[model samples]
Target: MSVFNSSRLAGKTVLITGASAGIGAATAVLFARAGSNIVLAARRVDTLKAVAEHCTAAHKQSGVQAGGKFAVVQLDVADKKQVAGLFDQIPAELKDIDILVNNAGFVLGVEKIGDIAESDVEAMFAVNVLGLISVTQLLVRHFKAKNSGHVINLGSVAGREPYANGGIYCATKHAVKSFTGSLIRELVNTKIRVSEVQPGMVETEFSIVRFRGDKSAADKVYEGLQPLVAEDVAEEIVWVASRPPHVNIAEVFVMPVNQASAGISYREPKV
Candidate 1:
């Protein structure tokens, strides 16, 4: 028997930030397969459209008669004007979003505190913290009006346990953790569900971006280790979204078997 209650997700609308790649794109596809309409938002409209096509294909393959529609929106969450006017850009049919996945986040570098560039810190916080808060605020208002919705944040193990050379990234995720916790408390009396999925060492473009396109450095980070992939984390996000109404998956920490913490991992010995 399947564990997911597909009925719960059918016909639901999900808005995913950073849907152009990584966990965001995977989540969009998974939700589409479950018969959910998706709004794919990211800076890369071309990539977003490709993801949308995949979503459509997934939904069709699922043989679901209803839902699974997609909207690809060019969004730079760091842009306040874009975030403020996001709904206007979305199609009217997808405006009533049932789920908001705050997954648009990135890390620029691995520089330590003293050596970190000012621009890097600003960029990290702008997208990871402020951008997430902005999008959530907009959706929160809508959810409050309807008294129904789910907010799933993409956090990181860095949020729980900080490590060297990841100060800014860790700080941003820590803010995400605090924000999610506060949101849960604020919505305790309401039907709105707030959850956070904190992943550790997911092998995605995240490391590449952190190292500024140095593939070798990024590869070394996961060398001799089987890191969690984007699909693994996406599954967790969808599972939390598919739970029964009364069951709120407050927080989930997902890491590979070899990963014990943000900085601790068991890598295979070099031949």
Candidate 2:
């Protein structure tokens, strides 16, 4: 086994949403390497399959002759019916999962409140807010019955501070924070742990999606300076998960060295 994994997460089942790309995909790889069986769910079947394969490959690369199992489910967490159906189809290996990474979320257009489309606002709330809650609510019952599990919600710095033209997105993230917070209290005195990993300006498909497929605009968001990559945030997720049973890492605020907050970064001009 890789020294990184050390079988620390051996035999655990981890479920990751938004596992088709970005931090979700990266986290699946890291956790699999750590000896966790992974269940990857995303809206894109083709992309989710690739990520699931990558998870098993990571275990092989870690020198484990028998790699951990990887499962994939095409899921749209924003759709409650789909979420329920997706859970029903989980393989035995993924049942009573030890961890739930609520990473299936998105940011819609970055326009002023007035200019933002109602669809954008609704979609953001549907996925980023209610979607997270739906998944967590379902899992909460499961965890309570088992009296064990961990929940890691993917929040953002925007959740703590809103930016111009990002009000709707920020509001969605803010709701995430609130939901996770309440979860902590509800799960208090239980073996279940609740945590949030709020990232700052990670350069992922998030930017491209936010810009409506404008690659050049997405590129500019990270031009002239380093931004947190999905892998960087993935490492943090693994680290937090690997903590001792007694240690519940309630929150982790991670960012590049150049970033002090959301939309507040020190970037040098290109020559």
Candidate 3:
């Protein structure tokens, strides 16, 4: 039986990076609904605040406010110092965090590998790979000391299969896949649980960022069929975190039915 039960997360504290929008925002709300106190962190303070309010409103509606907790922090995960500082602030608000969702990542520019600028590739690694490693390691150190915690790394299907023009982005995600697997093996005997959630072609600001605000280019990624929504990914995060203490879901990849693989997909417009 799957140990993904809501009651498993009751009274737990969860710190989610990139909670301002996209998959991170969705997971924050889902975790809040499941009775976990939420620490929402993102680069945009206003956006984070709005997400927190939404979670609070949902908790109020369901009569889950008894112990429901939420807070927002403006953070840029790329900064190692800031990442460590943000983790320090977690304990003061909701005590020790039982879950850490390292979902703060973005792709700057999308181009064929040969056409890509050197700086763009560097930025991709700066945020996607290095930032993720720093944040996860910081949390692992904290959790290892206490001997308990769940780390969820947000990866992409592109990690498994490289696409035509998204080489750097795919490389970063591939690193996440490898790093997540390695972390799980290294901490296999410990109480800390590390899991990776790989999502494919979600309708969000992801493509816009990749194309540098080129709406037309961004639209091309989801031209046909119903793409995965942020809420869909968020629900998976909550489920993975809700698993029984003894159960650890190492990796979960969520993609639309139309998306059979990273590069191959059934598009509506026949692009």
lDDT per residue for candidate 1 within 1-271, as digits (tens), equals: 4346667899999999999999999999999988999999999999999999999999999888778789999999999999999999999999999999999999988788899889999999999999999999999999999999999999999999999989999999999999999999999999999999999989989999999999999999999889999999999999999999999999999999999988789999998
Candidate 2 residue 194 C-alpha distance from true site, Å: 0.4
TM-score of each candidate? 0.99, 0.96, 0.94
Candidate 2: worst-modelled 10 consecutive residues by lDDT:
1-10
> Which of the predicted structures, 2 or 3, would earn the higher lDDT when compared with the native?
2
Task: List the candidate 1 regions with Cα displacement exceeding 4 Å.
Answer: 1-3
Q: lDDT (0-100) at residue 221 of candidate 3?
A: 75
Q: Write the per-residue lDDT of candidate 2 for residues 46-65, one digit (tens) a residue.
A: 99898888887889877654
TM-score for candidate 1: 0.99
Question: What's the CA error at residue 188 for candidate 3, in Å?
Answer: 1.2
Which one is best on lDDT? 1
Best candidate per TM-score, number? 1
Judging by TM-score, tell me the better candidate of 2 and 3. 2
Please state every model's RMSD to the true fold in angstroms.
0.8, 1.6, 2.3
